[model samples]
Target: MATLYQLHSSMDKLRRSTEQMAQTWRAGDSIILLGATAAFIDWLNAYLEDNDIDRIASIYALADDVAQLGDHTNAKLNLNTKLTAVLSDTEWVTLTQDPQFDKVVTIAL
Candidate 1:
């Protein structure tokens, strides 16, 4: 298979998985977004509001990704995100090892 085709397929699968998660969102479902997944936030928020679904959303984002998006609003873009800039591999492994964080149905990173 062509590299471009594989990339597209992977992206399509990711989008579908994310959309399904958003659709069936529950109160305690916290999102650990890796890479640059900020664009989905607005849509997810709107979907929750429009459906009258309430969730205590804890969004974890990489500080570097937000910076790469440009500091247009002086970091206001990360107002709702828990930014982690210097977390090591071991730190992440430890954090995700919590039993409560085991509901990981889809990982896009």
Candidate 2:
């Protein structure tokens, strides 16, 4: 089964301490959600830019969440250009129900 981890406004934690991220995610199978923090895109972009081995499989972010970022243009461009699968908030429930993802883990930063 696929493992799903929710970073509740704690993306910075993953940047500083990658143990949890590494434990739950495996490279391209991972999804990026624009949490409450604006730094999420920066951190994610930096990581993706610096590391070629770990490619983002998909991204799930509400339109409002993406708008909160100061540089939504670049962020949106990055996500759209890099990922083929982009899900909205409503689709999260459907994804969770998928047989592929049976385990949903919520991690707070």
Model 2 global lDDT (CA atoms, 0 to 1): 0.55
Model 2 alpha-carbon drift over 4 Å, by segment = 10-12, 37-39, 45-56, 70-77
What C-alpha lDDT, on a 0 to 100 scale, does residue 69 get in candidate 2? 56
- Cα error, residue 33 of model 2, in Å, equals 1.2
TM-score for candidate 1, residues paired by index: 0.54
lDDT of 1 by residue, 1-109 (tens): 0000000113334555445555556666555445455434455455445555465445554445445556664255544453323234565455556566544554442
Q: Where does model 1 exceed 4 Å of error?
A: 1-18, 22-24, 51-53, 73-91, 107-109
Residue 25 alpha-carbon offset, candidate 1, angstroms: 3.4
Residue clash pairs of candidate 2 = none
True-structure RMSD for candidate 1: 8.6
Error of 2 at 52 (Å): 10
User: Residue by residue across 60-90, what tens digits does model 2's lDDT show?
Assistant: 6655665665575646557555534446677
lDDT of each: 0.46, 0.55
TM-score of each: 0.54, 0.61
